[model samples]
Target: MTFLNRQIHFTAAPKRKVLVGFILFLFLSFVIIFVEPFDTDQYHSDHKILVLSGFGILIFFVFVIYSSFENLWYLKFRKVWLVSHEIASTILFFVVAGSVLYLYNGLMINQGSYSITSHLLYLKNIVLLMIPVFAPVMLYLRQQFGERIVPLPINSVLLTGENKNEVLSLEKGNLLFIKAFENYVEIHFLDEQDQVVSRTFRQTLSNVYQQIPFLEKCHRSYLVNMTTAKEIIGNSQSAKISFIHGEKTIPLSKTYYKQIKNRLVQK
Candidate 1:
């Protein structure tokens, strides 16, 4: 009985990948931010505390944003899109973090505690710090989670009515059958409580088939999910399909009776 009023489904990246990726990102950020390298720039060598705090905050923000956009990374061109997005996000994070550091460091310099340096050197150091954060993460996302990405249709189906603007992403798998009701269709499926639920959608049988091709055309008014079909009742001229857990039957046109039987055998 859940109501999802959205344009499309957003299946997330695998949970394991998100957990592992977050841990790796967190560890790397801590080391790069807090661990002072031997070749630290003179201008930055004294502001270790400020720099560490700034990068830490930025790293947390990046982790949240990356996880939220994980669905985008599951598309066919995932590696390219994900890496490009990470690179762009990293640059943006650097700019925001740099502005904060600039204000803090400028105040320290004015108070004569830290020495001044060329702005170009400061920007170069920020880029150097950002490289380790972005490069390896992109490579890891592409390599680790690429093959585990779920198929596009398994997660959801896009239902578009006669009006192209009227579109919805319906959950997949549980769909049992669709019945045409005049200009609209009734989508029947099992809900989480194991109860049969039917929803009215402003779409015809043909429109439904275009989005859900797996459904078998049993009659002019009905499309049944062959996987859920239990038995065929009566003869070829007047047969009806019976579904699991229910006695209600769907009329099967003689034209589609043989095709449905053949499809059942293939399954």
Candidate 2:
């Protein structure tokens, strides 16, 4: 069960992408921050810092939502990106909420019509406005992530380094293909039961490649079990080998044609 927590990649996830959005939000919050109500440079005051913080939080969300919607290339390698990205977003929203409140207070002051009695009162107003956005943001992030690591996947194949009891109860058998998942082999049978059962095999792919002399290296990532191989099929341009063990076709490259032909002839 503990092994289930292990990820295919070794690197720790990058800080969330939300931070970049947050920075952008902060830069744009100036429009409201410098408006007549809370113009910091116009009138020097220590309270201006509070106004900046408030505005920064509110604008964070807008930037995050925009950026997260785009195609970010950095997301492919680092898993931790969402953390920093989201934190930045969350901060931006609150900053916006705070900025709105403080700006309102300053506007009220200019009008001499209404004003918050204390600094605490202004702070309270800002915080009260920001809390409501949390639930929806979290829900949106979850839906966007969909519990899957990558939002858009290109080539998805399961590799295995070992062989014991490979089970993917959740996915279908037709989609099941073997590949090296780190030091272990995950017989990624997607359509099995509900749970993916992985076992500990005691050999590396390289070792297995050597010991199983009959099997041919179809690809750098794949080694076919020749004992279970039935026939080599396909045209010269795109070739694939049919396997008897899994009744599946392991792809063959043009360069490996000579070796594959030799093996089949020997058999």
What lDDT does the true structure give each of the candidates?
0.62, 0.48
Q: How many Å off is the CA of 211 in candidate 1?
A: 0.8
lDDT (tens digit, per residue) of candidate 1 on 154-252: 566666666557655556666678899889988877777767787777887897897788788999899998877888889998998888845668899
Clashing pairs in 1: none
The lDDT leader among the candidates is 1
Off by over 4 Å in 1: 1-172
Error of 1 at 259 (Å): 0.8
TM match of model 2 to true structure: 0.27
Query: Model 1 Cα displacement at 201 (Å)?
Result: 0.8
What is the number of residue pairs that collide in model 1?
Answer: 0
TM-score of 1: 0.42
The superposed Cα distance between candidate 1 and the true structure at residue 47, in angstroms, equals 54
| Predicted structure 1: lDDT | 0.62
